[model samples]
Target: MIKVIKPGIQLTIQDLGRVGFRHLGVSRSGSLDTYAHIIANRLVNNHDNDAVLELTVGLCELQFECDTVIALHGADLKATLDGHPLYPGWSYPIKAMQTLKFATGRGGSRAYIAVKGGIECPEVMGSKSTDLGAAIGGFNGRALQSDDIIKITPYAQPWLYNKGALTPPKRKVIRLHQGPHHELLTPECINAFCTTSFTINPNSNRMGVRLDHNNSQIMQHSLSLHSLAVAPGSVQLPPDGNPIVLLNDAQTTGGYPLIGHVIEADLHQFAQFRTADSITFEFVTLEQATAAKSKLDAHLSQLKLSLNRYWAN
Candidate 1:
């Protein structure tokens, strides 16, 4: 069991998210950084879809009721267990009554915490991810609060740990793929979109990220289109002309005009973007996006293979 003494900026339970219900106007609510969440789970030898805690801006404090192995990943939040620093991408064992604390993040916006065998919560609509808009899944379908007792399942497998920690690669440029409506944009507008740098807005969340552009007039001529299916990392331009990148909990459909979609492999990088951080989008071909995704999948597969080998020995 885990006791929440502090809930941080915003902490909630998340997994791969509930899928295939968008036709009914439900959002695909899940972890904003799918890659990091899955990596954290794998580091603890838990199922990739197992429920884990997603902490935004850190500052979460919890106490363990029993000996448990946990893994930390995603953002660098300067987490420590019982006053000892904890590293991302590595699993560490915690004794009973030990306290865990996470300081404010220095480089990222969110962090993932995975315990052995995952957190046991009542699943809703086939997932444990919190859908804040509709108030479903997670701990009563909302961000965690003080005094909440989260049940942790007993670890069935043997206790195992990873020796090394994995950190995300530093990303300065965000890559984008032109959408079907890219041709609808004027040549001048497209040029400005690529040339200018944008800062992430403080109002960003799992639903979408608001980007601050150098000049809003560049999107003055952009027109709204019919509502279409939106996915994570889709850059949409609203009536205000500011670009909002949709995240995991974004609505399935949106009426805003799309500028482009960020490739899947790089979407997790955006999850770490802090307010005021600068980012420039570079357009890439469909082939390039596909190749990048394939490469990432291969790397994940190799990690799984290595994990199996280590456990076998």
Candidate 2:
């Protein structure tokens, strides 16, 4: 068990998110950076979909109530255990009554903390993710507050010390595939969209990230489109010409024009991008997107296999 000392800016429990519930109008609210979330769990020898705490903008603090293994991943967040610096991608053995704290780190906006056996939270809609919009899951379906108690499984495999995995490359260039409403965009609009760099707007949240097109227009001119189904990573162009990259917690459907969609493998990178970060889009073929996802899947599979061996021994 652990108690929240400071709840950071926006700390919440998340798994891989709600699955197969979009039809009921529920967004898949989960960790924004799935790569980090899964890696954190992997280091702790937990299942890939185990629930962990997602901390945004750092500044969270927690005190452990029992001995357990823990791991950190995603954004650095400059985490420390009992005043000792802790690095990401590696597991640590934390003693009872020890305190862990985090400070803002460079490069990313979110970090993930995973405890052995995962967080013991109630599953809502087959998932332990928090849906802030619906307020239906996670710890009472809201951001964690100070003094809140989070329970952990008492029994867990012994902590195994191992070197962390290599960090993923920081690619500010996001690869995108033409979206369903690609036809609505004129050639000049498409050129401008891909050629110009955009800054992530401060108003972004879990639902979507608003991008300022650096004074460039998203479309050469206005073209209205009817409402259509959308998924995470869908890049929609609203009336104001700013592009919004819909994320895990985004609405199921949207009326704006779909210009492009970020590939699944790269969504983690997109999620880690912080406010004011500069980004540019590059178009990719379907085959290229498939290959990238396959590569990442293979890497994760191997990492899981490595961690499994440690636990099995």
Candidate 3:
């Protein structure tokens, strides 16, 4: 069990997210950084879909009430337990009443904390993820607050020491697939979209990330289209032509024109971008995107194998 002493900027429980309910007007609410969330859970021997604490911009403080193993991943927020620095991608033992705190993240936007048996939050729509816009799922369907007590479920497997800390692969350029309307735009506009660097706006959230391309003419362009089903990582261009990347908590449908879609394997890293951070996108063919995803799966399989080897010995 753990008690929330301070509920950072925005901390909530998240899992893989709810699905098969889009027809009911419900959006799939889940961890924005799905890769990090799954890795954190696997580090502690929890299922990949287990519920974990998703900390936005860090700044959370909590007290453990029992001995348990936990892992942190995603953003490097300079976290510490009882003043000692805690490393991500590694499991650590937390003694009873030990307090853990996370400072502001220096690089990424969100961090994930996974316990041994995952968080014991009630499942709504088949997931523990909190959807703030709809006020459903997670801890009472809202963000955690100070004085809230989060219960930790008992683990089925015994606590075991596994591999040492892990280092996430460096993100150089995000790969994007051409959209359905890629041919509609002029060659110069398309080239500008791919070559120019865009800054992440401060108004970014789970719903979507608004990007600033610094081109007034692009924003002046307008388009009209009927609303269509949208998915995570879909980069939509509004009437103003600026891109807004739909994220985990984005609406079920949108009328904006889609400019492109970020590759699935890189969406987690994209979710961790902070405001004003500049990012460049590189276009890739569908076959190339598939290969990239396959490579990512291979890497994760290797990590799992390493953990099993450590436990076997």
Compare the candidates by lDDT and give the number of the best one.
Answer: 2
Q: What lDDT score belongs to each candidate, Candidate 1 first?
A: 0.85, 0.87, 0.84
Comparing 2 and 3 by lDDT, which wins?
2
Q: Model 1 misses residue 294 by how many Å? A: 1.6
- Decoy 1 TM-score against native: 0.95
Best by TM-score: 2
Model 2 poorest 10 in a row by lDDT: 213-222
Q: Residues 1-313, candidate 2, lDDT per residue (tens digit)?
A: 9999999999999999999988878899999888889888888768889999999989999999988888898888899999999988888898889999999977688988999899988899999999998997889999999999998975445555774865567788899899988886778788888888899899998999999865554454577777888999999987677899999889999999999999987888866788889999998999999998998888888887786776677
Reference-based lDDT, residue 261, model 2: 98
Q: Cα miss at 312, model 1 (Å)?
A: 1.0
Summarize candidate 3's per-residue lDDT along 88-125 as a digit string, tens digits: 78888777889999998667888899998899978887
lDDT of model 1 at position 228: 88
Q: How well does candidate 2 match the true structure in TM-score terms?
A: 0.96
TM-scores of the models, in the order given: 0.95, 0.96, 0.95
Task: Report the Cα lDDT for residue 265, model 1.
Answer: 79
Off by over 4 Å in 1: 155-160
Q: How many backbone clashes does candidate 1 have?
A: 0
